[model samples]
Target: MKRFPIGILEFLTWTIALTGLFFFARVEGPHAGLCPIANLGLTWCPGCGLGRSIHLFLRGDFLASWEMHPMGSFAVLVIVWRQFELLYLIKKQLKSWQTY
Candidate 1:
């Protein structure tokens, strides 16, 4: 059996993750997050609220999304751009293989 290329795996991972985020509802109430730091009784976590932020941004609540996290919209754009970049790289790699 042939192994899958890392680029393909990465693209799929990003696609699935974003798709899930796009469909899932925004988390409500306190302590609803899965942050390990918050679970550990720490109140501050740099990465906390990022997922909720993305969810809000996807749902068309830009203000709420920004309130949740400043980089939410930017994160979405970067992820999408990376997906396209991965596709381009994967296509180029396949073309290279076809020449052999």
Candidate 2:
């Protein structure tokens, strides 16, 4: 029962994290906020190019997006998969509840 709300929250949390990752990456060097990951380590992290990639994506520049991250395509696929899985779980939950 309570699992339903937990699942919904999990979906929201990840989506927010993804959106924030995109925005944070888009900024120029030396953003005024906190990002311990970029600060504590090298300039290039796994998410280093994500901002540029996201900007390009929003503008419908597919090539530029891919240029920013070679595995940018995988990122999109993973996001879609996560969303679909969440929806599937919700649907299954609702169906089970109705049968009870």
Candidate 3:
């Protein structure tokens, strides 16, 4: 088995995190209607709709995800952008990884 570079590992880490988040977002069963923020007297929190947004995004429902939570989508975009940017840099620095 071949070992990947740090950049590759970083990308994989982020991808795995997203996969977890996606699964988390898709949980819409028994406790779906519960919102602690309502009782806490807070209008919003970063994770307020993250789960639903992520779930909708994984299902390819972009508009629904946006409606659910705009910040999560933005977070996803930033994650992907950084991963791709890191890959580009790796390719440029490592001649052996040029074809990657």
Candidate 4:
């Protein structure tokens, strides 16, 4: 099978992640995410509520998003910025190729 380029792979991964977060259902009580610390049976993890926080942020619940994780909004901004960066890189690469 042909392999996907790194840029394409990254773009797809981020797209899927954001899309999933957008559709992620709100959960009450404990967060059931794939956090290694939580999986290790620890009571607290710094990154635990990030996904839920992003989900809440996407759904326009800023206060709850902040409550879920202080960096959630910032994380969203970074992720979106990364997406744009990837697109710019891809566009730059295409333009360079056209010059050859």
lDDT per model vs. reference: 0.86, 0.68, 0.75, 0.84
Measured against the true structure, the TM-scores of the candidates, in listed sequence, are: 0.81, 0.65, 0.63, 0.82
On the 0 to 100 scale, the lDDT of residue 62 in model 3 is 91
Clashes of each: 0, 0, 1, 0
Which run of 10 residues does model 4 get worst, by summed lDDT? 1-10
Q: What are the runs in model 3 whose C-alpha is more than 4 Å off?
A: 1-4, 30-43, 96-100
lDDT of 3: 0.75
lDDT by residue (1-100, candidate 4, tens digit) is: 3333348679889999989988965647754577788899898999878888899999999999999899999999998999999998887777666666
Report per-prediction Cα RMSD to one decimal.
2.4, 3.4, 5.0, 3.1
Error of 4 at 66 (Å): 0.1
Model 3, 23-77: lDDT tens digits are: 7555456445467775586877667777678768777889988988887678778
In angstroms, how far off is 5's CA in candidate 4? 5.5
Candidate 2 lDDT (Cα, whole model)? 0.68
Query: How much is 81 displaced in model 2, in angstroms?
Result: 1.2
The residue pairs in collision within model 3 are 25-51
* Candidate 2, 10-91: lDDT as tens digits: 7787688667765655534654535567778657677766656765665567898888876766676677689879878877
The full ranking of all candidates by lDDT, starting with the best, is 1, 4, 3, 2
Which candidate has the highest lDDT of all? 1
- Using lDDT as the yardstick, the better of models 2 and 4 is 4
